[model samples]
Target: MNFLVFVKQVPDTETKIQIAGDGKSIVEDGVNFIVSPYDEIAIEEALLQKEALGGEITVATMGPNRGEAALRTALAMGCDKAVHLEDDAFEGADSYATAKALAAVVKKLNPDLIFLGKQGVGTDNTQVGQMVAEMAGLGHIGMCVKLEIDGDKIRGEREIEGGRETIEVSLPAVVVAQKGLNEPRYPALRGIMQAKRKPIEKLTVADLGLSADEVGAAGSKTEFARLEMPPAREAGKKLEVEPEVAAKEIVAFLKNEAKAL
Candidate 1:
């Protein structure tokens, strides 16, 4: 069995963010970057499946040069190789365009299973996995918390509003993994050294036989209209009044103004 894991790079979750001066983009200057945590789970799941079943796991992503870091992180986690889809054409791509680009490569690879994080931090749109599945016409499962490979078939678990449910899916499926699926592993020193020798194939837009009209900002359906900073929240006040007196006053305020009991 062969597994293809899609990884992505985004601003580190800890970084304080600011909207760009244009109000249509993030101010990425001096911002730290990291692998999307959700994708980390996907990578871990792929690694575990490979370890248990014995197969090659390939990691893929499309991004700027800095994205190599994310791929290296995956390398440390245990993917056998990496494919980077890089081109000036891919910049500012929306989820739809991004998925289209990813689908093209995934089709070219034609792996037995495709795994992706349920969402990416930068967009948090939770749409790319579905979009990729749609574009590829693969059996799609999103928000999955568990996965099992039985010969060529796949059995899995997904979360519902109330609880979890088991499901049976076929191979050549697209699975968007959720956080609870697995704990991502840290790179061992030996793995880091080994990762340097792992092959990372780079593809340009032309390599996929995709037209300029088929990808990037121009190909995207949605436009990022604008962004704004939220107003700061004010601090609450406290009184030194007696508890009984305060309780009575709080009750009166709740009933008359705050509208709570």
Candidate 2:
């Protein structure tokens, strides 16, 4: 079996973020980058799948040159190969365009199964995985937490809004994984050494035979005009009273002021 895992680079949530002057984009300075944590879990699941089913784990990602860091991290975690789809024209893609680019990369790889994170923190849209599946004309299962292979089919456990659901799907499918699928493996010395020797295929927009109108801001049907922070929370005043009265006051405050009740 050939398995392809889609990975993405995102701002480390630990870092502070600033919106750019344009308002639609983030300010890059001082923002640390790392693989999307959800994708990291997907990569771990792919590795585990490969270990049991016996296949090469391949990773694909799109971004600026710095995006290679995510691929390298995947390699260190035991992925056999990687492909980096990079271009300046790829900046600010909407979900459709992002899916188009990713589907194109997956076609070039021609894997039997595709693994993707349930969501990328960068956008948090939860749209790309399903969009990619639609673009590729493949079966898609979203929010999968547990996956088991049976012959050419896969059975999975997924989280729905209020509960979990089990599903069975045929092969050559796309799966978006949630956390708890598998614990990601730390990069081991041997894996890191192996990763250093593994080959990574690098492609640009020209390599994929796509034009700017097909993948970048031009291709995106949606546009981000501006983004602003929400209004700040006002400070609360402390209330002083006897214990019983204070308790009643607090309950009243919760019901009226906080509206949490």
Candidate 3:
């Protein structure tokens, strides 16, 4: 079995984000980057699969030069190799273009199984995995919480609105991993040292036979018309009256101010 895990670098969840002067992107300064939390789960699941099936795992990602850090993190997590898709032309790529580029790379690698996070934490767009599967002409299972491989087929349990659904797909499929699939392991000191020496192949749009007009902002099907921060939360009100009075006040507040009665 050959496993390919798609990882992404994103701003740390705790980081405060600020809109850039361009009004379309976030300011990169003072931002702490890490592998997307969900992607870590994907990588962990891929590692589990590799351990059971006795095959190699490759981690792939697309970003600027700084994105290499995410790949190295995956390597330290035990992926056998890494691929970095970096190019100025890839800047400001939307989900469709990202999926297209990833599909192209998947074609080149032709792994038996492809794994990715259900969504990128930075964009929160839950579209790439399904789009990549469509572009690659492969079956897709999203929000997968548990996965099992038997013979040439994959059995997975995916989360749904109220419960979970079981799915079976043939080999050469794409799976979008959700949280609770497995706990990601911290990279060992020895593994980190080994990762420093692992080979990382870098590629550009031209190398993938894709044109600038077919990716990046040019190929984006949607555009951000405006960017704004969420409204500030209002301070909470406190009741100082007796318990019975406070209960009445709460009801009145809910009915009038909150309108949630």
lDDT per model vs. reference = 0.90, 0.89, 0.93
Clashes of each: 0, 0, 0
lDDT of 3 by residue, 164-227 (tens): 9999999899999999889999999999999999999999999888999888889889888778
Best-to-worst order by TM-score is: 3, 2, 1
The alpha-carbon deviation from the true structure for residue 156 of candidate 2, after best TM-score superposition, in angstroms, is: 1.1
TM-score, cand. 3 vs. native: 0.95
Give the Å error, residue 25, model 3. Answer: 1.2
Name every residue pair that clashes in candidate 3: none
Q: For every candidate structure, what is the RMSD over all alpha carbons to the true structure, in angstroms?
A: 1.9, 1.9, 1.5
Kindly indicate the candidate among 1 and 3 with the higher TM-score: 3
What lDDT is reached at residue 235 by model 2?
86
Query: What does candidate 2's lDDT look like per residue over 188-247, in tens digits?
Result: 988888888888898887888778789978789899888777789998878787999999
Off by over 4 Å in 2: 238-246, 258-261
In model 2, the Cα lDDT at residue 160 comes to 85
Better of 1 and 2 by lDDT: 1
User: How many angstroms is residue 4 displaced in model 2 relative to the true structure, after the best TM-score fit?
Assistant: 0.5
